[model samples]
Target: MTRRVLLALLLLGLAAGLVGAAAWAYEAWRDRVLEEGDRRGEARVQARWDEDRARAQEAALDKARQDAAETLRRLNQQQENERAQQALLAQLARDRDAARAAADGLRLRAAAYLDAAGCGHLAGDSALGCVREAAAEIGIALSRSAQIAQRVAADADEARSRGLRCEADYDALTLRLSML
Candidate 1:
């Protein structure tokens, strides 16, 4: 009976130890699984955050590129307008000079006609006709010259007005670009 009791006690102790060991192994496995889950969750969250940040950066960069393109287009248009205005101004100046030269030539012709006439001692109808025809020609030349001068003056004034407008537009464009 004593030997049987001792054997029973030893068996009970061994069974308790085995149960404790199994519980410890189960707890350690559970802890490891929870830790792995936490690590996976953290990795997923970090990946999402990185994706969000990259998308935001791409959006910002695209907007910047669009703005730069728009600004370049405006600058190019303004420069083209300025060049056109300058060309127009140059043509107007050339026209003005040509008109001035034509007028000068008409004046010289009128002076020569007046000097060549000998109307002081004219007594016959032929002589009178000659003087009248010369006077008519001189009058026509002077009138034409006056018309050309008036036209030139008007054109110069218009060109000046347009030049001022173009300059104003250029200045405004420059100021707007500077702001960008």
Candidate 2:
């Protein structure tokens, strides 16, 4: 009976040792599995961070491009406005010169009329008719000057209102030439 009991004790010890070895192996494998899972999770997080960073960079670049385009457009607008202003100023100067010339011509014409009207007692009807015609011519010339001046003033007002710097030179030129 002692021998039988010793054999049974040895068998039980061997079984326990086997179970402990198996349990140790299972724990090692479980720890490795958990570590691998953690590594995978960290890699997934890093990928998401990289993607978000790329998206943010893209958004910033897009905003910068838009800002640059807007700036360029504003600069172009300024240049265009400056050119238009110069054009208008040139037109105004020409109009003023022409207006002066027209006035001078009118003055010379009046002098000629005066010289002709100075001949008294040459035929009362002819003398009176000459004076009347001269007066009508002078009136027409004066009226034309006033009309041209008014139109120029109106054009200036319109330019100011519309923030434009372009004038119609032909219209003013026509009025001045008519007086001449």
Candidate 3:
């Protein structure tokens, strides 16, 4: 009976040691699982933040591209307008030069007429001579009138050109404002 009791006591001690070791291993496994779950959660949060930042950058880039395109379009329109204005001014200059040449021709013809009429050689104040002098005076008056009319016409044309230029500038300014 003494030997049997000692064997039973040893068996009980071994069973207790086994139970303790199993509990310790279970606790270690649980701790590792919890730590892995926390790391995964942090990675998900960081990914969301990076995605949000990328989307914001993309939106800003799109807006910048739109603004650049609009600016380029406006510049092209302005350059085209300038070219048209230059062409109109050149044409106006050519027309003015042609008109001046015609006026000069008319002036030369009037001078020739006066020379042919010979009113300056008035011989004795006869009625015929008076008539000739009167006709020459009328021709001189008509030439002076033509010169005055030409000057007035030139001034009117200049004013018209200036007004057209001012109107075009105003239209350009309004167009730019509307685009903005």
Best by TM-score: 2
Model 1: per-residue Cα lDDT over 86-175, one tens digit each:
776677767777877777777777656655764333425786768867776776778777787768786776768587767766675676
Candidates in descending lDDT order: 1, 3, 2
* Clash pairs (backbone) in predicted model 1: none
lDDT of the structure predicted as candidate 2: 0.71
Model 2, residue 16: displacement in angstroms?
2.0
Q: Each model's TM-score, in the order given? A: 0.58, 0.62, 0.56
The local lDDT score (0 to 100) that residue 126 gets in candidate 3 is 76
Off by over 4 Å in 3: 1-35, 120-180
Candidate 1 vs candidate 3: the lDDT winner is 1
Model 3 per-residue lDDT tens digits across residues 33-60:
9989999999999999999999999999
Q: By lDDT, who's the top model here?
A: 1
- For model 2, residues 118-166, the per-residue Cα lDDT tens digits are 6233435876768766666776778677678758765775567345522
Mark the 10 consecutive residues where model 2 has the least summed lDDT: 165-174
- Off by more than 4 A, model 1: 1-5, 102-180
Location of the lowest summed lDDT over 10 successive residues in candidate 1: 114-123
Error of 1 at 164 (Å): 6.4
Better of 2 and 3 by lDDT: 3
